[model samples]
Target: MGVMNELIDPPGIGTLTRILTESAPMVEWKQTAATASLLGDLNLRARTDLVADALVADISTGPVPGYTTASASFRAALAAPKFTGWVLWPVSEAAVTLALASDAAEDFNDCLALLAELTPRLTGEFAVRRLLARDMDRALAAILTWTAHPDEHVRRLASEGTRPYLPWAVRVPALVRRPEATLPILTALYRDPSEYVRRSVANHLNDLARHAPDAVVDTARHWLAAADRNTGWVVRHGLRTLIKKGHPGALALFGFPPASVAVSGPRLDQEILTVPGELTFAFEISNTGTRDVRLAVDYLIHYRKANGSQSAKVFKISTLTLAPGESRSISKRHAFRQMTTRVHHPGLHALELQINGAAHGRTEFVLEMA
Candidate 1:
């Protein structure tokens, strides 16, 4: 709704300075004073790095102070009741930074524990990437235990922090290459009582689907076998990407089989669209099969890129079963606005129907920049 960077916009510098000073009385934090008023121009990740590096630099003067002082300072701050919120983003990062430097096994464990402790305030999700990058197995071995933690936040971290493609978090290349690595964690929590934890598990599965759809579908199958009331939502969300792409396994998992249907007129109300406006479009699907058939109807917007080529994005529309000779009409009002995620470039565009993973009824349009 607003500038995306403001979403992670931390507390004011004065607020951070005061909190740092008061939360960890054991540390001097000298370098904290000089951080420029330069934070506004930076996005969330850079802003976090700026503050964290300063905290690392200011930890302690002792020769081996990096890991020692920072961990101590973070622990001391944990003891203070007020050490929480978006400001903890940088604090967690600082702890991870210092821990990455140490060869001690305990430091790695402490770092993981520190992240879990810090997550309740503000996610240590971003910071934990350092540990994951350093040694994924070691980090995951420890993180697996978090699924059983009493706090749902910690359980969510166990899934979310290990996501193969966690947004705004650093990529764990190993996780991408080996999507199955985190499946055990997901397995443990898919039926979790807390919706917050299950939601993270769903997103984690969705991330895995980007790289390994088979593994994700299989995992979803396992989850289905042992489902709770919330498992349906989790499995559906986890399979979203695969469903959009028309992966048969995902489609079948959702009861949307290969549909024998005919599509007609994804006709646009206007063949030309002005920016910051709305386009109304409608389409119809009819059963072409003799027996009942289910359909997962989707739509694609082939957006024009800057170089005149097009990239398509799929959006879900609806799902239904059509009996022999039955027809259903669908209509939608799609808004075109300049959001941070996508830009509207004036050019030739197209819309199409995707029924059960098959493309049909393509209609062309033009986007005129307003």
Candidate 2:
């Protein structure tokens, strides 16, 4: 199995079963073991399903009063040594699913309480999604309070959980329509001392940028006014998509002035390449106008796909300021190695240079199989 698969594979299930059994000694170990064994024949989705199944089996057979009581019992059992970090992901997810199944508001409250302790172990981000769907106002109010919590993980959950487009989780339509609802949470944590929290805030803002560009640009301007190094980093990172698209407002906010530059010397070191080969290219940019100019330089490679089509992927080269009459040379070497993520087919590939989002220089090269 690959490194990623190992995290949720059989060993991970075994560890979770052992911890659960130890945490709640009253749990039916025999039933839990049987459920775990059944997980081996299942794929990823089946494995997660089995985790919930095992939790249900344990709860039914073990001494449990209700969902809230069961939640508390399981949580109490998950003390130190056994449950911690990414290794506990399967267990955490199972617990969250079980908690969400409860119909009682009190049960959800209990789950939220458990998540505060469990989030640092894995993440309560996914768990909170159900709460938001259940009651947006209530969930947002609680999450807003969490933003101020002493624990950076809880603070991060406040932002991460409310993301309009959180990956691997269902989209929050309310947030998608009214992203401003999250501004208060973002405002509280934009300059958070923890890089972990700040990164989440940046990502949250990036997600908002997708549907609410104007709002995001406004926020960027507001944040940039008194940005410390860390806050500035968040603003820049948050504006990555806008930067790539060469949004004039975003560029202007970053002081990347209008295009008063000239680009030349678009050439490839080789016209033909084989698998596992290296392609070297160089270009130069000069500030022809009588003023300093901030520039965002990037290059795109149109890779040949197996189905005789091309897809372009952009890569950043540099971001800099150039004085009047100043020129700079940029060079890059890209490997054409076979990657599991992408299949490279032999064909003519196009290379283009983008300055402030406009394609200025172009070249082509041939890629062949070894």
Best candidate per lDDT, number?
1
Q: lDDT tens string, model 2, 220-287?
A: 89888867779878988898898877767787787775678889867899999988899999999999
RMSD of each: 4.4, 4.6
Over 4 Å off, model 2: 1-30, 33-48, 60-65, 78-99, 133-138, 163-183, 206-214, 241-247, 263-288, 307-309, 317-321, 325-342, 346-348, 362-370
Cα RMSD, model 1: 4.4
Q: TM per model?
A: 0.79, 0.73
Give the worst 10-residue stretch by lDDT in candidate 1. Answer: 1-10
Off by over 4 Å in 1: 1-27, 33-47, 262-286, 315-318, 325-351, 361-370
For candidate 1, write residues 1-370 as lDDT tens digits.
2364554453444566666678666666666655546576787667778877888887745345778677766776676566776668888888888888876768999989988988997888888988999999999999999999999999999999999888878887999989899999999999999999988988999989988998889889888998878999999998987988888889888788787888888889999999999999998889989999988888899999999999999988888889999999899988999999999899899998888888898899999988
Worst 10 residues of 2 by lDDT: 1-10
Estimate every model's Cα lDDT from 0 to 1: 0.84, 0.77
Checking candidate 1 for backbone clashes, the offending pairs are none
